[model samples]
Target: MSTRITGTSHLKSENVNVWFGERHVLKDVNITFPANQVTALIGPSGCGKSTFLRTLNRMHELIPGAGFAGKILLDGTDIYDPQMDPVNVRLNIGMVFQKPNPFPTMSIKDNVLSGLRLSGRKTDDASGLLESSLRRASIWNEVKDRLGDAALSLSGGQQQRLCIARALAMNPEVLLMDEPCSALDPGSTRRIEETIVELSESMTIVIVTHNMQQAQRVADETAFFLAEDGNPGGVVEFGNTEDVFNRPVDGRTNDYVNGHFG
Candidate 1:
């Protein structure tokens, strides 16, 4: 059974498997993301944490020979259904990459509205959406006065927040982040973590992070992934954040979380 918020699931993966050509990277992974909450995916490198995050939004298929099996459900509908358009799926499930990727030539304000414009979706109030998105990202005060400046003019942390604002302008139902804070300094990471917690009040968030302290700080739930002895990665344990870190049922989970071994 999956967790439910207000009588419905937010997003979930059922027996999901992934392949890069013939190499199986992930196997039979199942996890549910409750609505209005933050879930963290934590694992060491080469454990398929990023791959699973990409799968959530159908971004995995972008690789030339990548393939996926099983269901990725959002609001009880499988996003991979043959009839579903991948573009629309992405629009509903926004993604932020490991590094901040704002368009270097675009202005800060333009970056925020780029998603809306590219999707051919018109908004009655572009300025309003821009301000709202930036505010939700906790960056409006910092960049509001420099909206016309080039996006690259901002610092690395600011660029990440701007990228987040760009995704927010689309008003996605679920947000997927892959190591969103790995490249930032401590102060910037703190601000981004704050933003993550605040965003969870309105929309579901699933983040992939290697920072154990970060996962415990912002996630309501955590799922630990591992691949041992040259095997494919899969969920070793999943549960509330505190439990997963402090009282995991699987000894492997305990070992990984306790710094015994990854």
Candidate 2:
């Protein structure tokens, strides 16, 4: 099986499949996440959008019985290789989840620095890194004078932005976000959307959302997944965002975009 896609590709999965014990969760998924751009994955509930995101950074293995076969490539390197460290893969491809899960015990500054410590990196450069990361997340000035405060003390939006800042402090080449806007208010959601668009100029982004309007707002490319038989998931359609939403090649895609199905 082909393991990598070269020529400016930031990430890819070739014939990837996932199973949880006897039940398959994902089937034969192949796609490329481009460098310095945002690729949105959208589908109805239980369609494996989040599973695909976890696979990108190798988080599917967090489940005890979960298993998968296929190569996940980051910058043309095989992330699933037997000799590769999953931790290293995750370090380079950071992730932000739907919930704002900053460490309750950590100071905001410490929250941003924690990943570096876990990855065994020095913290000397953190001041500048933290400043830049929080700035990129659009939360710098709001929390600048209170960096030592507990991350959990922030409002829901601030906590989420802090999580984004934590991810950014890693200097990741790609960022995977799973329904990041789901729990946020419109104003905060808009700021995060703007951040995604801006960060796309420097880092490859893969976001999974059920929100069609969100997909249209920021995605340069979009992939639609379908859960056939209410079981295993598969890619039903994929193409440029404009075409996927406006001139889909598949009837199911057209129906989904037109709000005919989940």
Candidate 3:
């Protein structure tokens, strides 16, 4: 039987498991991302951190042989319900990748609106959304005059923010990010971290990060994932960020937060 989650959760995973062909990647991963808060997933590479992130909005199914069991609920509704459309799921829950992935051929303005246009969503105020989204992503001042410039023309950090702006243009209720600052310089990383904190005021955010400091700085709550001795990945411990980092209940979590081992 599926467990019922209590409290004011914006997004939640209940007994979620994921597989790629014959290999199980995620095992019974359960998490509740509270509304307007940032929840970070931290773990070593190959521990299914990214895999679990993709499962949030059914993005995992895009891969060949990728499958998952259990429910991913958004506001008490199972997004994986047969009656729900995947396109709408994605539209409501936007995602930004690890690397900056702006459309190489599209202009800055066009890139931000690309989601809406491709989704056949007509915005009465495209110009207003373009500015507001860029502003929210913290890149409006940098690229305001250059809205006509190619998205790739911006720096690595700028590109990532542009990608963020693109996601924001959809007005999603929740945002999923996969190590968005991993590729940028420290300065850019700091800026992105600040943006993450700011965005949390308006929407639920779930992020995967290898950087413990980043998680501590931005996440209100944190979950640590681990896959040891040929086992599928699962949450070792989860709680308020301070507790997860400073007073982790699991020894493994303690080691991870203290940099003893990944």
Candidate 4:
């Protein structure tokens, strides 16, 4: 199976500030994610990179006391608008978490089709969609023969790809990954990185990664965030990946990316 390029869109953030019950986690942030490209958010552990990633599709608000002020726009439309349902936003922006989390009880085939079922979408060609999605995730060849097997039966890397396949089944315009390769081994990480690069040709992608090298390898653009002196997290620098890594304008960005400090 070859890569399937589908939904694509430009995502932008404007004056975005987030608070978790009065504790500000993210200060005013503004960034733009070009269509069919991968943007990486790189920072130290408590810098709120993952928090900002969740805000792209309104997932940040799922936290009990979380609140944010600002606009997250998809194709110029504010996704946080009261009239814009979060479910719809999520449908267009799929997410994969830090760990591989396939539904243990569901078969590999069912796992790929789970999104369609959850979204209440009906399609006559479920089998085709499953195959294409798995292929797009770069895992179809590995699991083609065991579609009826339980999802947990696959290896860790395969499970992660399966999750990506499931997300692709929704035909999301953007894909948000939060340290999707953090728990994987070197080989698995490389495969996931390859999948990310391949997927970017068809969808907008934003990833939160602590590894500067990984960011340099997979990201087209990079944003550096920091939370210093007890201040809230915010982007310190942003630019093309190569420039951000090799010729950062901000001293802090240089320090972080060069292993001097984080």
Record all residue pairs in model 2 with backbone atoms less than 3 Å apart, i.e. clashing: none
Model 2: weakest 10-residue lDDT segment is 1-10
For 1-262, candidate 1 gives per-residue lDDT tens digits of: 1222132337999999999999899999999999989999999899998999999999899998998999998888888989788888888889998999999879999999999778878899999999999999999999999999999999999999999999999888899999999999999999999999999998899999999999999999999999887788999999999999989999989889999876
Per-residue accuracy of model 4 over 111-183 as CA lDDT, tens digit each: 9999878877778999999999999999999999999999999999899999999999998999999999998
Query: What TM-score, computed on C-alpha atoms, does each candidate reach?
Result: 0.96, 0.95, 0.96, 0.96
lDDT of each: 0.92, 0.89, 0.92, 0.92
lDDT of 2 by residue, 1-262 (tens): 1222334447989999999888899999999877898999999899898998999999999999999999898777888889777887787889999998999989999998888877778767779998999999999999999999999889898899899999999878889999999999999899999999998988899999988999999999999999978678989888899999999999989999899988
Query: How does candidate 1 fare on TM-score?
Result: 0.96
Cα misplacement distance, residue 146 of candidate 3 (Å): 0.8
Poorest 10 consecutive residues of model 1 by lDDT? 1-10
- Model 3 lDDT at residue 162: 95
Write the number of the candidate with greater lDDT, choosing between 2 and 3: 3
- For residue 224, give model 2's deviation from the true position in Å: 0.3
Task: List candidate 4 stretches off by more than 4 Å.
Answer: 1-8
